[model samples]
Target: MTLLRPQIDPQIFSALTPRDDFRAIARWVEPRSSVLDLGCGDGSLLALLGNELEVRGFGIEIDEKGVLACVQKGVNVIQQDLERGLRLFEDQSFDYAILSQTLQTIHRTTAILSETVRVARECIISFPNFGYWRHRLAVMQGYMPVSESLPYQWHNTPNVRVLTIHDFDAHAHAAGIQIIDRVILHKGRVIDWGQNWRGSLAVYRVKRYR
Candidate 1:
């Protein structure tokens, strides 16, 4: 299998740029692992992982422009709607399956997540935190919050179901999965306390329980 080899100079790899959440996700991945990226917009994260960790990456994207961009980046990508599920892929086909900033937008959350877990040994997911203090404050003020992570008006947003870290934890438990690692991010910084209340984004590395 072709895998990306980590650069000899760690500094060079550190200097390689990525979105904050993407960087967090990349760090959780082991070097030279196979990855399946769902809703990989423009193949940015996949390309970054391939270059930084020597991960063999495959991406699934629905948008034509995004698919074109992935091709230009030399990233292997298949065009497919995530809501339809991952029936095309077989069981345990990859080391990690990732869904970043796209969970809320998918209507079939449970189904897609199940497929992700089935297709890979581990699954990594990242999404906006609806329980953030700002969102609460906005609700208190009788309006939806507008922030960097959630940059859309209520009616115009693509996100159908925004959830919190606590919500996700409960969902995972109900789905018979275990969260191996969790990270909460607020304005690009890692926050320890009151993650459900203060965190703007939540990330998790998970696996199905035996």
Candidate 2:
């Protein structure tokens, strides 16, 4: 399968300043807790959590360049294809498993979510919200939306499934995963209202039902 590298913001590559979405996820993590970051591009978020929260952090990345970047930053990372699944990790091995901005690219979203919730006590997930007004307008206009959060044209996009926070909430409920926290963002600003149609991005903290 041909892997498409989504266009990442240059700010995501920065070491000093963490991205707002990363920060939002970070807030859910407890200090000194064990964390597994799936698709941890360049290990920026893991590094941030490691430094700020003093967590035991491991990462999984498929791209060799991203793996090398993680190693250079002293992050323990395993280069593996997530689509093949995460059976290697034992259930409840980590305090948290994170799929930040990588869920849309995954073909087996349900399977991955099941495994993630099973392997960790909790999971933190972030993604671009397809229900944003811009995306809705683009669809109505017969064009795929391209914006800062989702910066790709339809033909070259890595996102196989585009979903909104509302969609994800429904999926989580049906899957028996409980959402513990949610943060919505529009143009980098945190918003509380109209998340389904106005928010461009969102982060969710969830755990499997006991």
Candidate 3:
């Protein structure tokens, strides 16, 4: 069964300019394909994909405000805890699944990632790199790192799992997930050198190894 693409206003489209990482994620998604967004906050990414790529998109958000915002943007959204898994969707239900910047916050990281790959032929995952030079420097000084990508304080932070590019690479290898492509970013610009130590954010397109 196919889903209808939401009809968003042109003004809204102009207002909701896709972030740099969101643009990167959009580049990986095929036009007119189906997408499932995990932990979609405010549905901006879904909206952008729907409008620009003409993709049929659905979003899962746990926050009430986020759900409301999605509704306002004419986005299809479900409000549910991500830890419960993506059982609602059948195997390969979407062409792409996105978990942007929410991987570290999820407790059942492995399970969620597995479910994501199960429900989608491909998945896009992005997270803040804990091994960035600044983050390491902060840790060496005996304080938790706080920057634009990781803006939350240690007490109020939602990031439970700290991971770097190397860590994710190892985990993906062990989990039998093939990394099709990867982009490392620092301040929205793609970093080409010393990604593990210099990049502040990591984006990957992956699929379950057959």
| Model 2, position 1: C-alpha lDDT score | 27
Best-performing candidate as measured by TM-score: 3
Model 2's alpha-carbon lDDT is 0.86
Give the per-residue lDDT digits (tens) of candidate 1, residues 1-210: 122222233333444457779978988899999999999887788888887789989888888898876776667888888888888889899999999998998888888888888899999999999999989899999998888889999989988988988899989966667899999998789989988998999999999777
Tell me the tens digit of each residue's lDDT in model 2 across 96-174: 9999999999998888888889999999999999999999999999999999888999999978999988789889966
Candidate with more favorable, higher TM-score: 2 or 3: 3
Separate clash counts for every candidate: 1, 0, 0
Model 1 ranges with Cα > 4 A deviation? 1-17
Q: Relative to the unseen true structure, what is the Cα RMSD of model 3?
A: 2.6
How does residue 66 of candidate 3 score in lDDT? 84
Give candidate 3 regions above 4 Å deviation.
Answer: 1-7
Ranking by lDDT: 3, 2, 1
Top-lDDT structure, candidate number: 3
